[model samples]
Target: MNEVKLIDMLSYLEPELLEDDYIEKDMNKLKNLISKISESSSLITFNKGLRSIIKIITFIIASLLVLVGIIVIIIKKKKPKITKKAFNFVTN
Candidate 1:
């Protein structure tokens, strides 16, 4: 005759592994939290990308302004030289 142990028989019972209502509720809450976190992470990534683009545009505009200022100074310096040449020519 073969004899089965109680522990082995209990392990084969399907009803023993059934989840309670609280466990199901907690699982749903966890799923919702995970989804919210994923959504927020995507938003943060988009904001970071937008900030970098804005910074690049600002830097380009500042560089162009500086270049324009340098050109203006060079032109101003040349104007006096031209005026002096004209004055000397008129006096001669």
Candidate 2:
């Protein structure tokens, strides 16, 4: 019922029920599959990082463009002031 008793029972029966060659082959297969999964997970993580970087860069560029546009509009809407001269010449 307990973990230790279960393990002891399995250990006592393992040699009679299981073959060493089959166990070794299965362990090797499991190791190879685990290695492949690890490699794929790393690649997926890298891709996620690249995507976030791209999004941040895009957001920064868009904000800058919006700021520049607002500045341009403000500059274009301003009109130059005109002043009259104190002394005016008579027309010929």
Candidate 3:
């Protein structure tokens, strides 16, 4: 019996194994795997986008702060210094 089964099995060994019925049986598993991968990829993309926006916003804010600091320094330097006596006299 074993010899007969082996001989029968060997007869169809050269054919391709990817038939429609085999795929249909595992369709649910394949769909679940695809959905999981798609969700993960979307999450990765969202994270990257969020990071990029945050970096851009940080750079802009830093640039604005530097510009404001430089402007403040320039204005302070342009202003004349008053003596302590003058300050006291003005206050009094």
Candidate 4:
């Protein structure tokens, strides 16, 4: 048997991606996806869906902030009442 070193021809762990048809297959899939995305109505629908998702998230975050602000205001108002009573007792 010839003890020839197949340095560039064989890899023990990595698959030979550059020499195979996998790239062509992947490119074809990408091309198909791009073509679908290029259609006017599909593009509009994608944009609309993305915008609605963003709007929904923004609305939820704003509602949460308002809720938290209301809770904080209620707690602060109660604290001032308790402090006022303590001061009145000290004055007497």
Q: Where does candidate 2 clash, by residue pair? A: none
* Tens digits of per-residue lDDT for model 3, 38-92: 9999999999999999999999999999999999998777655545557878999
lDDT of 1 by residue, 1-92 (tens): 23467667767778756655788899999999999999999999999999999999999999999999999999999999999999999999
> How do the residues 1-92 of candidate 2 rate in per-residue lDDT, one tens digit apiece?
99999998887785657765887998999999999999999999999999999999999999999999999877666422111222233221
For candidate 1, the lDDT comes to 0.91
Lowest-sum lDDT 10-residue window in model 4: 1-10
TM-score of each: 0.62, 0.60, 0.64, 0.47
lDDT of 2 at 70: 94
Query: How high a TM-score does candidate 4 get?
Result: 0.47
Clashing pairs in 3: none
Could you tell which candidate, 2 or 4, scores higher by TM-score?
Answer: 2
List where candidate 2 sits over 4 angstroms from the true fold. Answer: 1-20, 79-92
Kindly report which residue stretches of model 4 are placed more than 4 angstroms away from their true locations once superposed: 1-38, 83-92
| Local lDDT at 79 for model 4 | 96
Clashes of each: 0, 0, 0, 0
Top-scoring candidate (TM-score) = 3
Pairs clashing within candidate 4:
none
lDDT of 2: 0.81
Rank list by lDDT = 1, 3, 4, 2
RMSD of each: 5.3, 7.0, 6.7, 14.8
